[model samples]
Target: MFGDVMGMMGKIKETQQKIEETKQRLDTVLIDEQSNDGLLKVTLTANRTIKNVSVDDSLLEDKEQLEDYLVLVLNKAIEKATAVSEAELSAVAKDGMPNIPGLDMFS
Candidate 1:
């Protein structure tokens, strides 16, 4: 029983390391989103860090419209990034988890 506990502890440590590595890798995963009218675009990392934002000059003429475009496009980019981050991290964690009976958290 102690041996099993030690093995499980080792597995948990490995999973933590993998999770950290996955987070570093996620920083390079980019997600791009654009406005419906193509006047605004955004790029973000899977870590949800904004990389860039491009806006057409036409959007500069209207403050409210530009704000709306920014909100919509940025939200879309964040959502996509969040999904990618979650999927990658979860896959790593689930793969590294020990097969403990009755603790089917991933399922």
Candidate 2:
């Protein structure tokens, strides 16, 4: 069964390569999201860290409204990022991982 052993080895190596590539991709991927009002936008890493946020100058006309809008927009942006990360991870994991999107690929 030497041929079977070699075939298994090759399959293992291919799976290992996909795992490494997905690990690298997930580590630094970021998603950008914008508010429907165009007043705020944010960038979030795949791991759910907010990298940056921007607000339009016009929103500052009302402080309380601006604050409320900021909170809503930030939450939306994070949600968008979470969706993006899940989609991407799903695509990558389709080749190997069968459990869930955020399962530990590197491990």
Kindly list the per-residue Cα lDDT of model 1 for residues 1-107, writing each as its tens digit: 99999999999999999999999999999999999889999999999999999999999999999999999899999999999999999999899999999999986
What would the per-residue lDDT of candidate 2 be over residues 1-107, giving only the tens digit for each residue?
68776775676677678767765675588777777877878887776788888889887788997888778877877787678777765665456533334766634
TM-score on alpha carbons, each prediction: 0.97, 0.56
For model 2, the local distance difference test gives 0.72
The 0-to-1 C-alpha lDDT of every candidate, in the order given, reads: 0.95, 0.72
Candidate 1 minimal-lDDT segment of 10 residues: 35-44
Instruction: For candidate 1, report its TM-score.
Output: 0.97
RMSD of each: 0.7, 6.2
- Say which candidate scores most in lDDT: 1
